[model samples]
Target: MNDGTQVHLRLVRPDDKKLLEQGLARMSPESRYFRFFSAKDRLTHAELAYLTELDGENHLAIGAARYLEDGTELGLGIARFIRLRERPEVAEAAITVIDEAQGLGLGKLLLTMLVLAARERGITRFQCDFLARNKGMHTLIERIADDVRYGHESGVMQAEFALEGPEGLYRALAGVARKEGHVRPGSGLPKLETTNDS
Candidate 1:
C-alpha cells in the first residue's frame, strides 16, 4: 500500500461482525491476553457476538480503515463506548486494532475519534480500565492523560480523560505519552509489524 492510502475513522456497522471476528482471531497471543486478561487465547463465539451489539446513539463504536477507491475495507481499528445511565456526561472506553495494522497510530487515531464522539454526545469525561499486564493498553490509555489510577489487586489501571467541549484528548494524549514514557506504537513491534506474542 502507498502512503496515500489513508486510514479513515467511522462508526462500526452490523456488516462488520465478520471483520470484528477476524480482528480478534488475528491478534497475537499476548495481545489477546492483554485484551481479555487471559492466560491463554480463547474467546467464546458468544462473547464476540455479545461484544458487537453496536447502537450508535446510546453505545458508540469508532472504526478505522484503509479503504479502496471502491470502499472495500483493507484494515480496521475499533473502539466501543458505553454511556452511563446515571451520568450521561461520562462514557467508558474499550479499543482494539488488528496486529498487522499496529504502529500506524490507528489506536491513537481511533481513540481521538471516540473522544470527539463522546464530546458530541454531551460526555464531559472518558474512562477506561485495562489489565496491568496489557502494557500496550496501559500505555495507550496513559497516552490520554497523566492522571491514571492503578488497582493492583485487580491488575486494572483506570484513566480519566476530560472530554468537555473542544478540549482535544488526542493532543493531550500525544503530549503525555511523549513525556511519560508512552512509546510510540512502532516502538513495541519487531522489524516486522507483527505483535509480540507471549
Candidate 2:
C-alpha cells in the first residue's frame, strides 16, 4: 500500500462469511456501488455462500487482510474469477477493495495474484463487466490488458482481453505491482494458497 501497510493475501474460506460481511459493511456506499453495481446494505445467505465456498479450479477467490499490532486481521480487498462453462479458456473476473484501501494499489496486487491463479487453472482470457461510472476499474483494466475489447450496454461496460501473448498479462501486472511498490527488491510476488485452509 502507499501508506506502507503490510497486507496478507490468502485464499478465502467458508469460515470467512462473517469477515466478508463485515468488510462489506465497512465499505462506503460509493464503493459498494462500484463493486456490486448496486446499493446493497447486506449480502444474502446464498450470496455469501457463493462468494466464500469456492472450488479452487473454477470459482477461485483471493482475499487481502491487514494485520494490526494486536494480531487482529482487517479485511481489505478481494479478487476472484469464475470460469465460463461454455468457454473453458475464459473467465469472468471481479475485484473489490474497501474504500479506505482504494488508490493504494491493493487492487493491483490482488489482481496480479488472481491472474496467476487463473493461468494455473488454464484460463487464457478474462471478461469483466462494470458500471460506466467506475473509472477506476476501467483504468486498471486498461493498464493491464493489451488487446482489450470493450462493449457498452445500459450504463455498463464489458471488457474482454487475453491473458497470454507477446506482452504477457502477468508481466504487465508485475510491472504495475513494482511501480506501486507492492513488489519488494529481491522478493518475488506474494505466495497464494490454493486450499481452503482456515
Candidate 3:
C-alpha cells in the first residue's frame, strides 16, 4: 500500500459472508453505488451466498485483506469474474475496493490477480459495466488493456477488452503487478491454479 500497510490476497471462500457484509457496510455510499450500482445498506442472504459460494470454474472471486495487530483481518476489496455460458471465452468482471482502501493501488493488484485467475480458467476476454462518472475504473481498464471497446447505455459505460493481447498489454499488466514498493516479497499474493471446488 502507499502508506506501507501490507495487504494479503486470497481466493474468497464461502465462510467470508460476514466479512463481505461488514466490508459492504463500511463502504461509503458513493463507493457502494459505484460497485453495486445502487445504494445498499446490506447484502441479503442470497446475495451473500451467491458472492461467497463461488463455483470456481464459472465464477471466481479473490479477496484482499489487511491483518490487524490482534491477528484479525480487515477485508479491503474483492475482484471477481463470471463466465458467460453463451460465450465461455468471455466473462463479466467486477472489482470493489472499500472507501478507505481506494487509491492505494489495491485495485490494480486485485485486477491483475483476477485476470490471471480468469485466464487460468480459459477466459480470454473481460467485460465490465460501470457508471460513466466512475473515471477511476475507466482509467484503470484503459491503462491495463489494449484494443478496448466501449459502449454507452443510459448512464453506464460498458467496456470489453481482451485478456490475451499484444505484447504491450502483457507488459502493462506485468508492470502493474510488479509496481515498485507496492508489492513486496511474501506479501501473500499467491499463484492461482485451476480447481473444481468453489
Candidate 4:
C-alpha cells in the first residue's frame, strides 16, 4: 500500500468497460465475494452495461486510477451510489478495491469522492451491505460515517448513514463539477470522457 504511488480519481465512462473488466480480472476470489457476496469472477453483459452507463443524477460512480509512467492506466478501485426509485434522497452504495490497493487509502478516497458527488446530487443518505465477518468493512464504516446504524440478518450486515457528520472530510477539495454530460476538472484524471445518458 505504501509504494508512494499517486492515484487519480475519475468518473467512469462507457468507454472504460475494458478497464473495468481488466480490474475485475485482477481481483481475488475473496475480494470478489467481499464485494458481490458471491464468487462471481466476471461481470455479466448486463452488469457491465449497468456499471458503465451512469446517469449521474441517480447513479454516480467514481474510479481510482493509477497512471503508470508508460501511459497505461490501472484501475485500483471504484465506489458508486445508486439512488432508490422510491426514495431518491437515499442511495445504495458499494465499493471494491483490488488486492494490491486494499489498505492504501484508495477506498477512503473513492468513498469521499462518492460523498461529494452524492451531496451535489441532493442525495443525503447511503446504505450498504457486507458480510457479517468483514472486519475491514466495519472499520471503514466506523472511520468515515459518524451516525451509522447497523443491523444484522441472515449473517449479513447492513449499514446506513446520514452522510453529513464526521466533521473533518476532504474540506480542502475544491470539488468535482458535472457539466454538459462530462465531469470537469479536479477529478484527478485529466483525460476524462463523457457518456451519452440522454
Q: What TM-scores do the predictions have?
A: 0.71, 0.85, 0.86, 0.85
**Model 4 lDDT per residue over 1-198, tens place:** 246666666778887899989998999988888888889879888899999998877987888777778998899999999999999899999998899988876677667767767877788999989999877788888877887999999989999998795423443331322332113455533323234323
- The TM-score of predicted model 4 comes to 0.85
Q: Each candidate: what lDDT?
A: 0.63, 0.82, 0.82, 0.77
Note the clash tally of each candidate: 1, 0, 0, 0
State in Å the error of residue 151, model 1.
3.9
Task: In candidate 4, list every pair of residues with a backbone clash.
Answer: none
Clashes of 1: 1
lDDT of 3 by residue, 108-165 (tens): 8788878877876789999999999999899889877889999999999999999965
Better of 1 and 3 by lDDT: 3
Q: How far is candidate 2 from the true structure (C-alpha RMSD, Å)?
A: 5.4
Model 3, C-alpha of 123: deviation from truth (Å) = 0.5
RMSD of 1: 10.6
Better candidate by TM-score, 3 or 4:
3
In the range 97-168, model 1's lDDT, one tens digit per residue, is: 877777666686667657766665677777787776667777776675555555554667777667643355
**What are the root-mean-square deviations of the candidates from the true structure over C-alphas?**
10.6, 5.4, 5.0, 6.1
Model 2 spans > 4 angstroms off: 165-198
Ordered by lDDT, highest first, the candidates read: 3, 2, 4, 1
